[model samples]
Target chain A: MTAEDTAAPARRGRPGYDRQQVLEVAVRLFNEQGYDATSVSDLAGELGVTKSALYHHFDSKSAILEVALDDALSGLESALDDAVRSHSDASAQLRALVRGAVGVLTARQSRVTLLLRVRGNSDVEQSALRRRREFDQRVAAIVRAAQAEGMIRADIDAAVATRLIFGMINSLVEWYRPGGPVDPDELADDVLRATFDGLQA
Target chain B: MTAEDTAAPARRGRPGYDRQQVLEVAVRLFNEQGYDATSVSDLAGELGVTKSALYHHFDSKSAILEVALDDALSGLESALDDAVRSHSDASAQLRALVRGAVGVLTARQSRVTLLLRVRGNSDVEQSALRRRREFDQRVAAIVRAAQAEGMIRADIDAAVATRLIFGMINSLVEWYRPGGPVDPDELADDVLRATFDGLQA
Candidate 1:
């Protein structure tokens, strides 16, 4: 093998960036700076490509954002779907959901961050928000299912429980960083434990 | 005095413009747009003032951010200080702190929104973060007091518990809105109860 072959594997997929690579960069840029603040020109510059090239990949900035978030959330729903099917009981399902949420929140932190901060300022934002509400309703249905089984408290509204769980889980984006003190798996365990056991002795 | 003169309270002290009012406007703008995205012109436009007029109120954009955060935090600390002094046990103190936090979060939702999203990109941002950490430590101290009182679980680290509690509480800024349904006081009560009691029956 020649020098090119030796370095070829290390530079794998460096040129001719795929859809995912571009979307990943876009997510970071959108999160680091505000979404409205980031332009097609900025995205192209960040990718070291021309604006026309980026336009070829996505028709518009909103198109890129639309697909990026739709992709992230679609991935999350699949993860939850698997977790929900794996568990037989409500307790197990809740634990699995929390753990799975941590996985998604950490692995796709930027994408999730974008999802949580949607202000409903534009049509794209409104659509993303509607999907988000739909996602929450799905999780609430599970929580309601749990409540019926005498696992979760029946007195508390399912909407409230869902909101609180979201409060605890959604916050991971702000403080959680991979390669930090606690791994996502371990952190998920503690979080699930707290959600179940409460902070009381 | 005439009835009209007596009905309306007199505005006194600072004549030109109230610094608090300016900071409030700036924070609202910061929350609507993000911190990095909000320019001085944006703030001035929001305030219905000229750029030069806005600069007279603040030396720089960072200065506006600095004093705004300081003012809000000082209000928070004042409430926290009272709560710490009045509560007999750690659990009660934590409850008081949580309640006080809701008031702070609601009254200055925009400021707290900006607070929760600080990325530490500048010296001002980093300093604000350091101050926030210290505040967290103070709350952790209260949590430790509760642990010593045998109200909260001793097995968990105070730091981690504090982080989770804060995470849940701070999330209100992301999703909460000012409306008649579930007031701030009720929201705070539910948060405190849920934090201490598992969602389980």
Candidate 2:
């Protein structure tokens, strides 16, 4: 990305910088080079500032990671809630959940991708893991409700199904290029159909 | 892993120490701790030996990585060959490819997982990338054959379809805990079934 993409340190002599903006650049770099491979100095360099300037915005790398991840977790939970409540039936709820998830992933590909790849290496990563587990638990509850309604197989473990769905959903980041042949919605539709319905016909 | 599971060193009478034996331990450590986090001394400590003893086996950590990777690639080629020969028809061939791929992942979970997560930090990683691309090309050829037989989607790029199949198949490594809730063969079967037949029934 260009320095301009990082936002000039003095575009029209704007205020110091947005905390959120710094986190965005940090997430982009983390996804591009991986969490361990990326450095705080590298992020500051990209933002057209010194390392001390970055320290001013975020106490530590993990602090930035915490804020970015919490933002994603909050967004995901609220979106899933809206999607689930939008429909009364299991099929509709599941579909809504898939589409809402696709919307989140497509919009915040970098942040979500980082979340999916977290290895519990640090306190920040472990916190991300806990929140992710909570997300899975919520999805599992919905899956069990769907099964009770006979919308999904009762034999399959809700926990396993939730993981499988997230695995497939998270994988979009690896292959779905922005200008690819299929649009994000189309890809999401294909995935939802493939997951919700069996291809015996 | 237990010490007995490690590949025994060649020309043993002394301590059975050699370049290959050291690499086996190093690869295991790398898989467990990740590539960037592992160091030469850390590897030596894991192998139940001193740093100099480890050094006597291989020149450096990089050499160990190169050798271990080469070993994994050779196995992959053999697995691909079997995938092609497992079945004759388009659909069966695709299923065989998925099942065989799963078998490979399960049998060599740690090694294959490490191979999949390469970060391209060095020339060795770059070579692994090239070899992976070649493997993807082989899968693309299989998808093309299936499409010609009217068993696969003709509209989507064959390469794109192949990658999605792999994304599903490879995800086994991330969550397919053996003796957990699911069996490997059954999981592979479900994956193959899910891949070819749309999930919607």
Largest lDDT belongs to which candidate?
1
- Model 2 CA lDDT for position A7: 46
Chain B TM-scores, listed for every candidate in order, come to: 0.84, 0.81
Report DockQ per prediction, comma-separated: 0.65, 0.39
Query: How high is the CA lDDT of each candidate model?
Result: 0.79, 0.74
The sequence of per-residue lDDT tens digits that candidate 2 reaches over residues A58-150 is 899999888878777777887788877798876577778888887788777777777877888899889889988888888889888887887
Model 1: per-residue lDDT, tens digit, B103-174? 888777778788777888899889988989889899999989899999998767788888888888887777
Q: Write the per-residue lDDT of candidate 2 for residues B1-201, one digit (tens) a residue.
A: 223533664333335555656776777788767777788879877776777767776778888788777776767777778867777866567667777787777776766777877868899999998898898898888888887887776756677667667776676778777667788887776676567664333
Q: Would candidate 1 be rated incorrect, acceptable, medium or high by CAPRI criteria?
A: medium
